[model samples]
Target: MKISKKKILELLTSGKYVPSTFKAIAKILEVKDKDDKKNLRKLLKELIEEGRIIRDSRGRYVIPGENMVIGDIQFTRRRFGAFVSRDDGEEVYIASDDTGFALDGDRVLVEITGTYRDLPKGCVVKVLKRGRTRIVGTFVTRGLFAFVIPDDPRIKYDFYVPPEGFNGAKPDEKVLLKITRYPSPGRNPEGVVDKVLGNAMDPAVDLPTVIFKHNLPEPGYFPEEVLKEAVKVAKPPTKKEISKRKDYRKDRIFTIDGEDAKDYDDAISIKKLKNGNYLLGVHIADVSHYVREGSALDREAYERGTSVYLLDTVIPMLPFELSNGICSLVEGEDRLTLSLEMEIDPGGKVVDFKVHEGVIRSVRRLTYTEVNRFLNGDNDPDLLKHLEPVKKELLVARELARILRDWRKKRGSVMDISSREVKILFDEKGRVVDILPQERGESEIMIEEFMIKANETIAEIFNTQDIPFVYRIHEKPDPESIIQLKHYLEAIGMKLRIPKNIHPKVLQEILEKTKDHPLHSSIERILVRSMKRAVYSERNIGHFGLASQAYTHFTSPIRRYPDLIVHRLLKKIIEKGHFSPEEIDRYEKELPRIAQHCSKRERIANEAEWDLLDMKKVEYISYHIGEIFDSVITGVTKFGLFVEIPEKMLSGLVHVSTLDDYYEYNETQNILVGKHKKRVFRIGDGVKVRAVHADKTTMEVDFVIVEKENNKNNKRNNSKNKAKKRKKKRRS
Candidate 1:
């Protein structure tokens, strides 16, 4: 008798087949020869590796089932537990004791043990693959023993380093370590120092530390082949290429961005038509034009997924020759673009539109500040002169933007959530000088409105054509989250009725009602949290946040990989009119995986940026220890209250131990109550706090309550404090 891989899979998949050991399977198949048994064993091993079959604890070959899952494990920020994110989008919770030495981001086989808090609870049965081999941390030595404390808070364990593995690394310095041994039930992981970054306090080491910590690509380092391809692809638009594209080189088209922005990926132009409609043209850099599909440049860009813009630095997705040179819609340079021209009526209805590959030379480059100043009636001669060329265009753009914004609001878009963005200013020596909250002026809003309209227009086009496309989808809020939000809202004394199947319009109404409330920011923060995160998807479920039926990111191809893919898809449609059946099938199979990869990469980039920002914030606040600031409690937990300083957008924890009275956390109401004094601290409570400590390594700030002002409101607390002081003196 003979055995084969196909036969093994068929047997396992058969309804009558029961899980059996290698010997049992061989006997059932009547494999009497020794060589046939060896062949059967090899086939079984290959099938298991391919995930076509799995093994039970008793070493029997079985099919994967609901009781078992394979997924990547992500530890919580507090490191108490982890969640395994499976391929089908289900998350299983893994308690700390059940983790079986699995680290963050490892792919593991988990056996579903039971249920925890409405989610499947699981334990790691086997670690299929390690997610990371390198870690960035601070090296320390104590009495002939050494270890590296990881900078990532999610990574809880300290990797032990042997004396010979130090590799000349010094104490308290940031170093990159390569893992030599993984952890087990009883032992810690071990690593060897690969490179000494520098002193933790050195400003020069900040970028490298964050880069290594996040496993980001080194800035300005491109593979030789990628660079060569970039150089070949970044050439100026040739005569033949321009002849093929719609030429808008002489149009009054220009770009508006931040004063410091260099990669101008999007440009705009507008005009009022005779029928009182606005002719708006949005030109985005055609990044896919240069970086062909499956090329080295495209592969590198896909791997990066998106550019990481760290404060004062950037890790770009494409090489400089493409991202900053030819692909950037620089002033007075003819650059290739995918243009969307829309005819919007006064009521903000898009009556007609056209999408085309075009060539445009930006007439001028504008900044948000100058355009805002001119629009706000600032009469400075220099400012007026700087924007004189396209003054009418700017005004028309403003008019059209207002109409579009009002239309979006009328359609129930979530528009009133005010987000505070802070700009960390650095001095000549790269030291933090100030942290100022950035204001979005009218010009900023105008650009946002235009971009949104363009994105919606492009998305609708592909969706109507029934083409396989990547969409920027924001699903509706989960009913469970909305219920929690409703309870919290009631607790905060806002009596708003929430429906089980809530609509985005209801959320909009809530924001409108709470716009002037003292806890507006806190409410906004909570509402944002209650909503699901927006991600790229091949399935168009509509964007709940923006109140759009179809939406995609078609702008900023220079920075975002999805936009580049959109461009390629749009170009394919424009050139071929429609995809062949085979092409459609291929894209249908590929787009979901691509969307998932890009979504994961985007999340990593966002986390890295936030981590670096938090580090800088802690560094800045370290200079202001003991200074009192007004703050609002944003979160309540058993351990402490998380408060954010509203003015600077800096947040810190007010530990329970730091409170004067012994407090008990009320989990149901999400509040903390003093055991004897009856003092209550809940979300949105205003308090005066003094910054007590800041830890750069942990990226955490500690705040202590300043009782002087708070005492004025509570005489009992003051009296209790005096009584305690008197008792302490008598005891002394």
Candidate 2:
């Protein structure tokens, strides 16, 4: 068996001294073929390179006991930078000295010098390897001296660039630079500008800045070979293909999506059976049909992992030829799809189900707005009497959607909603003209509800067949995070009402209470943030958000790679009936790694999206500096209360030191209590503020609390707030 990296580290720490001789190690390892010097040399070289085994003064190997072990480098940005020693998927603090020469994200060998209680602390004695090649930053100049200030605060060191070394760029330009010379002695990290995009304040540069910062793969079209393969979709599921599977093309099915949606991945059909049961068919685009395994297109899709839609632009996984054409379930087009046909009883219970590959013909491509308008009593050319049958069935679908939603929630689904979205409106130059709220309505929710049912049903079917499938699992919130959340809510004058079992039902009652209140959005926002992010995994852990017993992503295989994996697994199961024990072992072993990769890719996507949104928000508020507004405290720290404005809904700090009263921070309550006046400003409290400064370089919109009196006597308070805001802006 091939040993894991952790196992290698474990062997190094087992004994105080490991024999220097290869023969001794081979004997200890119980290898009968002792004369195989090549393999033994390879092992020795690997160990030395990894810093597991070290050669002492006279060439004797020594395993440095429990004090030394190799682990990944991690950095946490606090007042005093703390590099992690052993996170083990949890936070474990280590000092900067512990990091030694190990770069961020690098796997290194460290000597565990000490421990504070149960917390493992270490000092890196060796550098195993380097980590990243790219660095994202903006160039700044002071006289003749120039430096590249990193956008990521976690990057502890700045880059020093000589005037000529910048390679043809003026000061204050946002550039993608490569680390040419790492820090040595008192010098900072030095680099040369690899690509100069534009000025830091240029609106067009922000998207590229976001892309570079997250280390997301550059958005590029698939290669010629991949495009050729992707474009080659089987003409139309032939007579032979139809004979091997079920046929749903003649079924009165239709797709509902956004007005601008190009790739329609899912379609739904509903009909009344003679047995007094409803037949519901959930049809999905068979993307795996054309993008076969081990192809160039497949590899690119795997690398991308999922489609990334940023504002109006989409970085699609598969080329447009496949994603928007052959694989898209367009209206009146014959497309191959994986269909889930289920017989639903009057009570919304799925009595019987079958999964099959089939040909589908979508009768119409209906937009949510069009359907919702019709449902809400409005006439349209597409639905003015000619679409009466489709419209009536749409209402029936909504009713069925309600039944499914109720059933899922009753089973244990946490259905929560929040009003937090950036609706993009771009001008002719692709510059953002406006960023509004993306309103969620009943029609969208109906589609979501049906999709959830389809996914859960497929998960159950694969489970029953003993097939290996990728499940969209969301584990419970971290115990520490949950505890912190509970305390935070309590401090805000509310309680979680969590029960002993720790289920979504604990939050259900709370959700129902604040359905449409002003603070409703904020409450849901906090709750959602408190929960862990959902990720793709082969293991089936029930979904916490959906509150489902079983869940898998089967609806959008065209965008999501995990869904494609699931689709392939289902097809295999359909043909072979079950997965072999060996195949199960392989999947079990590989799943953890797959989950890790998918999670990382998902983070990249989120970061890219959020970074762009933050830039846009910053730009949106840049014009409103010095404007006054009403606000409420959304966050509290020792430094100040973070006040969020009501109009634009942007958050800025109201420093405690600037409150015109001496204050002390209360750790337990997350508040700053004024000493003399006894004035208390805490999280969730109301406060008025005025925007004093908005710095584009820092992307910070600063605000000072609007005190009733700001005369000559209050000069110190105004100065303090101004000074604090300026300091933060400069640092950022």
RMSD after CA superposition, every candidate: 5.5, 5.1
Candidate 2: list runs displaced more than 4 Å: 1-97, 101-103, 108-129, 183-187, 232-239, 274-276, 380-389, 427-433, 464-467, 499-501, 646-649, 675-678, 696-699, 707-725, 728-732
Estimate, for each residue in 1-732, the C-alpha lDDT of model 2 and write its tens digit.
Answer: 343445445655675535556556555555555355556556666776555666554555567566666555666544254554331233344677556555566666666666754566667665555566778788888788888888765677778887667877778788888888776566777888888878887888887787777766556556788777765753566778768778877788999899889999999998778987778889999888777777787888888888887766788888888788888999888889999888887787999988898888888888898777877778777576656547767877888888877886787677756557757666787565666767766788889878887888988876666556677878787556556657767777775566545777766666786675445556676777778888776667778877776788889988888788778878877778778899888877765566656665776688678767777777766656555678878778888877776455566766665676888999988888899999888777776676666545456666677765443535535654675666755675
lDDT of 1 by residue, 95-207 (tens): 98888878888888899999987799999998767888999999998788999989887887899999889999999999999999999868899999999999987766778
Candidate 2 TM-score, true structure as reference:
0.85
TM-score per candidate: 0.89, 0.85
Candidate 2, 27: how far from true, in Å? 18
lDDT of each: 0.88, 0.72
- Quantify how close model 1 is to the true structure by its C-alpha RMSD in Å: 5.5
- Distance from true location, Cα of 39 in model 1, Å: 16
Best by TM-score: 1
